[model samples]
Target: MTVLGEPRTADERRTPDRRGAVDGGAWRARARRWWPAAWGAVLGAVLFAVAHRAMPDDALISLSFARNLAEHGQWALTTGIEVHTATSPLNIWLLAALHLLTGGHAFLAAGALLAITLAATALWLRDLGGDRVALLGTALLASSPLLGSAVGLETYLAVAVLVGLVRYAADGRWLPAGVLLGAAVLTRPDLLAAALVALLVLLPGAPRLWRALPVGLAVALPWHLFAWWRFGSAWPHTVPIKGNGRGWFDGSFYLWNSWPDFFLVSFTGVTVVALATAAGGLAGAAWSLWTRRWVPVALAAGAVVHFAALGLSHAPPMMYYAGPPIGALAVALVLAADTVRWGWIVPAGLVAAGVAVSVLHGPGWADGLAPVRQNWATNPEYEAIARDLPTDGVVYSSTEIGALAFYCQDRGCTVVDGVLADPGRVDQRWVAPWRAERPWTALNYRHYRPPAPIPARWRLEMGPAEPRPGDWPITRAPGVHQVARLVPEG
Candidate 1:
C-alpha cells in the first residue's frame, strides 16, 4: 500500500465516537445521581455547627488540658496541680495530638473528627447493606446534631471502638476487636457495659468462650492496672466521684425522671419515625430468626441489649450515651426503606427535618447567666486582668477559674467550681459562701466563716449592690478591695 492509502476507514473512527459520547453521557448521569449525597454532606456540617452553638465547658477544659499536654508535656489533669487521681489519660493524649496536628484550632480539630466519623459510619453501613444503603445511613449520621456534638477526639475514640466492633462482628476477628473495645473502655467506662454485651454476642459458643474470653481479658488488663493505681480503684468511675447522680434502684425517681430523660434524648427525630423504626427493627429480628436471618438477628439483638442494659443504669443518660441506639435507629431506618429508584428521599427528608429541629432548639448552658456571659475568659475583662496582674503569681477567683486558667495562659490563676478542673472537689459549702447574696461580714459569718481560712493576699471583688439589714453587708468594709477596671493597653 502507498503512504496515504493505508489509512483506517471512517466506520472504525465513527463507531468509537458514538461509544465515547455514550460513556460521557453515562458519567453525567452518575454525577447527577450522586449530587444529592454531595449536597447532603454539605448541609449536614452546617446543621451540626448550628446545633452545637454553645461550646460545652467540659469540652473546653479537655481542649485546654490537651493543649497544655501537647505543648509542654504536662501530665497533670488539673491545671497547676500535681493531683493524678483521675485515671487513664488516653483521651487527653489523643486530643492533644489532634490539637497539634490542627495547629491548635479547636474548631478545625472538631471538623476533622466529624469527617472521620462520617467516613467510619459509611464504611460500617457499606459492610452491612451494600453501597446505596450505606450512603443513606451516612447521610443520616452526618446530619444528626447529637452525633455532631460528639465529633471531637474525645468522641472519636469512642467512634473508633464502634468501628472496631462493626469490623470484628463482620469478620469475627477477636483479639484486635477486644483491644479496641478495651481502649474505648479506658476512654470512657460507660462504654464498658456495652462492650461486654457485644463481646458475648461475638463469642457465643460456650465451647470457644474459654479461649476467646482470655484473649479479651489479656487486652483489658493493662488499662485496669493503670486505672487501679491512679484512682485507688479500677476505672475512672466518673458517675460516682464526679457528680451527685446517685440514686436507689427504686420505682420513684429512677423511673420517672431518669428513664424519661433517657428516652427523650433517644427520640430526637419525629416521634413516628423513632417509634416505627424501633418497632420494625425488633420485628425484623423476629422474622429474621424464623427465616434463618441469623446475622441480622444477632446484630439487632446485640444492639438492643446493649442499649437497654446501659440505658437502664443509675448514672443518668446524656446524649453521648445514646450513640449506639442512634446508630441502631439509623440501621433500622435503612432496613425499613425501599432502596430503589429515588427511594433515599424518604430517609433524606427525615434526616433533614431532625437536623433542622436540633439546630434550632439545642440547649446552651451559658445563655442565661449575666456574669458568665459578660466576664468570660475570652472577654476583655479577663484579658485586661491578665495583662495587669502578676503573671508568675496566681489570682484567686470564684466561678470562672476554668476560663481564667485557659484564656490568661497563666496556670497560676485559680477559679472555684469549674466543672472541668474541680469535678467533685468543688464543695457546696465553699460555693455558697463564695457566692453569697451579700458580702461576707460579721453578721453572715457569726455562725460560720469560710472557707474557714481565707488566703491573706486574695481579696473579694464586689460590685454595687443593695444592702439588706440582717444579711452580711460588707459595703465599704475593711479588706473589700475593688478590682480596678483596666482596659487593653493598645
Candidate 2:
C-alpha cells in the first residue's frame, strides 16, 4: 500500500549522480568545457560515413574482390582482386581482416574498419596534442567530407600509419614509430618521406638507436621479403610498372582537381564549420611559420613536405591523406582561438550545429552505397558469366573482375588478368585486345588498323557497342557475338 503520489526515497529514488557525473550547474560547466571535443568526434564520424558511402563502384569492387580472395585462398598475398597494380596491400588487408572477423559481411566489415580508423585517428590526435587540441584537430578532420571518401582506401591507410608514426615520435617511442613507418613503406612507397621525417624526429635523442631500429626492421621484414619474392623486385610497389617513372611531377591533374572535389563533397554533408576552422588554422600556422615560431614551424614543415610528396604523384592522393595536416591545423586553430585574440570559440557552435544536422539526417546516406555495398549474389550477371568456370580459367577483366572470380574460383575459374592482381598482367592484357585484332596477333577488339586477322583460338565478343554508322563493317565481322550486357540491377 504505497501512496500513489509520494516520491520514492533511497533505493527507489534516482541514484545520485555518479562521482564522475556533473549535476545541474556542474553539468553546464562540464558541457561548456567538453563540448568542442565531443562535437569534433561526432562530426568526424558523420563525414567519414559520407565519404565511405559515396565510394566509386570500381574501388569498392576491388575491395570486395580482395576480401573474397582472402576468404577463399585464391591469392597468397592480400593483394587486391584485379590485375595487381602498385597500390599498397594494407587497405585491402584491412578490409579482408574486417570481413574475416565479421564472418564475411563485406560492407559491414568495411564500414567497421572505416569507423575504427576514424576513432583511432581521433585518439592518435589526442595523444599528439592534449585533449583540447586533439578534439579541435579531430573536429577538423572528421567533419571534412574528404575523410569519408578516403577511409579504408590506400591513402587513408598511409595517413593512419603516418599518424601512428607521428604519435610514437611525439612520445619518444622510436621503435614503434619506425615500425609504423615501415608498414607505411609496404603500403605506399611514397611514405618514405614520412619515414625520413620519423627518423629525423625520433632518432636524435633515442638512447639505443641500434636496439630500436632492429625492432622496427623485424616487424617490417616479412612484408618486404614477401614483396620481393612475389614481384621479383625489392620495390615492387612503385608506379614504374605502368611505364610511369618515379618522378613526382607526373600526377598533378589528380592532385589539384579531383582532390578538392573529393574534399568538398565529404565536408559539405557533415561538419561544415570544421572547414572554416581548418582554413583559419592553416592561415594561422602559416603566419606562425613566417614569424619563425618553432612548434608551428615544425608542424608546417612536416605538412608541406607531406603535401608536396602527394602533389608530386601521378595519382591524386585521397582526402584522408590530409588528416595529419588537418590535425596540425587543429592544434594551430586551438592555439589561435584561445591565445590569439580569444577568437577560437567562434566556430564552435557551427561545428555542433553541423554535427546535429548530420545525425538528424540518419541513415539516408545508405543510398550512396554502390558496388561496395552489394555482395556477389546481388550481382548475378558476373556470377552467371563465371559459373562453372575453372578456378584458374584465364579470363580477362578489369581490377574488380575478382568479384566474378570469387564465385567462379570454386569451379576453378582462373583470371589471367585483373586491374589490381598484377600490374604487368593488366598492362599485357591492355595490349592483348589490340594485338588480338591482327593476323599473327589478331587482337580481340577488331577495331585496330591494317585489317589485322582475328585469332583462331580466341573468341570475339562485343559488349553493347554504341551505334556508330562508319564502324558497321568492323561490327559485322565474322565470329562476333555479344557475350553479356550489364544493366543496373537497381
Candidate 3:
C-alpha cells in the first residue's frame, strides 16, 4: 500500500513519464510561439503565387543583364560593351546568382525570391500589429495590380527593405536600420530621397545617427565609385535617356499626371482605402510629430518625401515606384490604428474592401490562377526576328530591347539599347531636322544617337513597328512612321 504523502513503488515515481510530459509541453510552447509566423509565411507564399502570374516587360532587361553576368562574365547589357545600364545593382546580383542556381531559369528564380521577400514583409508587419493586421496588409499588397506587375522587379524587394529599416529604427537599432536603408538605395537609387527623410526623423531622437550614417555611406559609396570608373558617370545611363534633358528634381509632371494613378494602383483599385491611407498618413505624421514618436514620423515623412521626389523628377507613371510609399502608408496606418480602441477594424475593413474591389474590377480568379506560361505568344515577333538573325549578329532595338535580348539569348547576338546607347554620338543636327515636325521625337533623340558609320562587318536589324491603335490626338498621327529602326548608311 502507498503511504500518505510518500512514494510507494519505483514505478509510481515515473521519472520518464514526467520528463516526457515536460518535453511535450515545451514543444507545444515552441509551436505556439512560431505557428503564427509560419501561417503568415504560408499566406504570403500563396498570395504571391496568385499575384505573380505574369512577368513585366522591364524584368526581361534585368534578366538579360543577369544572364550575361552568369553565362558570359559580363556586367554590361551586352557582352564586351562595358556599359553600366543596370539600374538595380543588388537585384542584378541576386538574379545572377539565381540564374546560375536555377539552371538559367531566371524568371522562376526571380518569382521565388520575390515570394520569400513578400513572406518576410508579412512577418515583420505581424510583429508590429499582431496577426490580423499583418494578414490583411499582406493580402492587400499581394492583390495589388501594381505589386503583381512588380513581382519580377526590384520594387517589392525595396518595399521589404524599407519595412525592415523602419522596424529596426523604431526599435532603436540604428546600425542595422542604416544598413537596410543603404541596401534599399542599392536596390533603387531613387530611394535615396526616402532614406534621407527617414534619417532626418531618426537623427533628433536617436543620437546614435553617427553609428548608422557611416555604415550606410560605406555600403552605397563603393558602387557609386565603381560606376563612375566603369561608365564615366555614377548615374545610370537611363538618366540621360529618360530624364528628357531636364535637371534632376526640376519638374512636377508626375505630380499632375501620375499621382492619381499612383494611389489607384497602390490601393488595389480601391478609392476608399487610398483616400483613407492618404488622410491617415498625413494625420499620423502630424500626430507622431506632436507626440515625438519618431518611428511613425519617419515612415510618414519617407512617403511624403518619396512622392515629392518622384514628382520633382517627372518620373513616368509606373506603379512600381509607389511600392515603398504605399508600404510606409500601410505601416503608418496600422500603427495609428493601434492607438484607438478596436484598431484592427480599420485594416480589416480596408482589406475586405480591397478584396471586393479586386473581385469586381480586377482580374477574375480563372485568370489569376492561370499558370505563367512562357511569354512567347505575346512576344513572337521579337523571337522571330531573333531567330532570323545570325548567331553573331548585333541588333539595335528601339523600345522593346528587353524582349529582343531575352528571346535572342542563345543566338550569341548582342542588343544595343536604342535609348541608352552612345550618348556621345548625340548631335543637335539629328534633333534639328525633326524638332518642329515631331517635338516629342526630337526630345527622345536629343541626348543620344546610334553610333555613326556602322561597320559593314556588324549586322543591324530592326523590330517591326507597332501600329497605333487609336485616333486620339496624342496617338501617332496617320501616315507618321514609327521610326524604331537602325539602318547603316548606304
Candidate 4:
C-alpha cells in the first residue's frame, strides 16, 4: 500500500501504480523545459568560435592596444605613445588580461572570451524567456554571418551586459543594474543612451533611481576622468575625425541599406527568421506598452536608442551595428511567446533550418578556421616591408595600420597611423585629393596620405603602390597614382 513513503490507494493498485507514470511524465516535462536552452548555449558557443576566427581589421587594432598594455605597460594603439584611442577601455583591459594568460595569443584569447560570453548570454536568455524562445533567439544570432563576423569585436559582450542590466533592473536590483549599465558604457560609449533609458525604467521609485544613478556614475567616472586628464577629452580622436563632414543624408541612406542588404544577400532562411523576429519584437513592444511592463519597455527603448544613434551618426551602417537591434528583437520575441505560447515555433523552425543549411552546404567550421590561416599567411608582405626598413625608419600606412603596426611592433621601425592616430595633423589636400579619380567620400579621409614631406631617416608607404609583380593595388581606378614611394616636395 506504501509506494516510496507515500500511501497508495486500492484504486492506484487497480491502475497498476500510476506514481511511476506520473514521475516519468514530470521528468519529461522538466527535460522539455530545460533542454532547449542548454542546447542553445552549446550551439551559440560553437558559432561564436567559428565566427571569431576571422578577426576583423578593427579588432586587430584593439588587439594591438591590448598587446601594448600587456608587453610594454602602455595603453595605446602604438607602444610608447600615451594616447586614449581605445574606444572600449574595459574590452582592452579584458583582452590584455587574456593575452597575458594565453602567452600573447590575442586571437585565440579573443575567440575564447567571446565564446564564453555568448554562451552565457544564451543561457541568461533562457531564464528570461522559456526554452523555446531562447533556442530561437540563439539560433538566429548564431546563424547570422554578420553577427559571427563580429565575434572579435565588443558587440556581443556589450549586448550580454545589456541583457544582464535589464534583468537586474527588472528584478529591482538597482545598484547591480546600474553597475552593469556603466560597464556596458565602458564597453561601448554609444550605450550611454541605453543606460539613460534604463534609468528611466527604474525611475518609478525615487530611492531605487537615486541609488542607481550614483552607482552608474561611480563605475563610469574614473575612465572619463582619466581620459579627460590624459587626452583633454573623454572621447577618442576617432570620434571627431569620423564625425566631421558627415552628410545629412548619409545616416538615412545607411539605415535604409543596412538591414535590407543583409537580408537580401545573406542566407535566405536566416533572413526569414530575422524578419519574423523583428516583427515579433515590434508586436512585443506594442504589447508591453499596452500592459505597462517596464522591463520590455526598457529593452525596446534601448534598441531604439542604439538604432537611432548609429543611424544618425557619421559611421557607416555595418553588420555589427545590428547586434543591439537583434538582441531587442530576441527579447521581444520571448515576451511575445509568453502570451502566445506556440507563436515562437515558426521563427524557431526557420532558425533551425538556417543552421542546418549552414552546416550542410555552407562553410560551417571552415569559416572560423580560414581566418587563422589567412592572417598567418597573408601578412608576409607587411613583414617583408618591415624587414626592408631601417631600424630608425617610420612607416605610415593608411588602411592597414593595425596589421602593419602589429607586424612592425618590435622591428625597430616606428609605425604612425595615417588616418586615426592624429587626424588634426593630416593635410586636408591629401585627404581630399584633386585630379582624375573617383568621387571622394568620408571613408577616403580615413585612409588619406599626408601631404607633408618626410623628415625622418626613412619612410615607407604600403598602400596601393605602383603596379608591380606583387604590389597590392589600393584602388582599381585608372590613372590613380596609387604609388607608395618617397614623399615628393610640394
Query: How far out, in Å, is residue 458 in model 4?
Result: 6.9
Q: List the candidates' TM-scores in order.
A: 0.62, 0.60, 0.73, 0.73
Name the runs in model 1 displaced over 4 angstroms: 1-53, 75-77, 82-90, 153-160, 204-215, 237-239, 242-244, 247-313, 332-346, 359-412, 416-420, 423-490
Off by over 4 Å in 4: 1-41, 205-207, 245-277, 353-392, 410-414, 422-466, 473-490
Q: Which ten residues in a row are the worst by lDDT in model 3?
A: 470-479
Identify the runs in model 3 with alpha carbons over 4 angstroms from their true place: 1-44, 51-53, 245-256, 260-276, 284-292, 356-392, 411-413, 421-490
Query: Cα RMSDs of all predictions?
Result: 14.2, 13.3, 11.0, 10.1
Greater-TM-score candidate between 1 and 3: 3
lDDT of 4 by residue, 329-387 (tens): 66655655555657667556646655655555345334332211212212334445555
Q: Write the per-residue lDDT of candidate 2 for residues 201-245, one digit (tens) a residue.
A: 434444443354566667667865665455433444234332232
Global CA lDDT computed for model 3: 0.59
Per-residue lDDT value at 378 in model 2: 23
Assess candidate 4 and give its lDDT: 0.59
Cα lDDT of model 1 by residue, 147-219, tens digit:
5444432554454355456445435555666666667566666555555554564454222433435665676
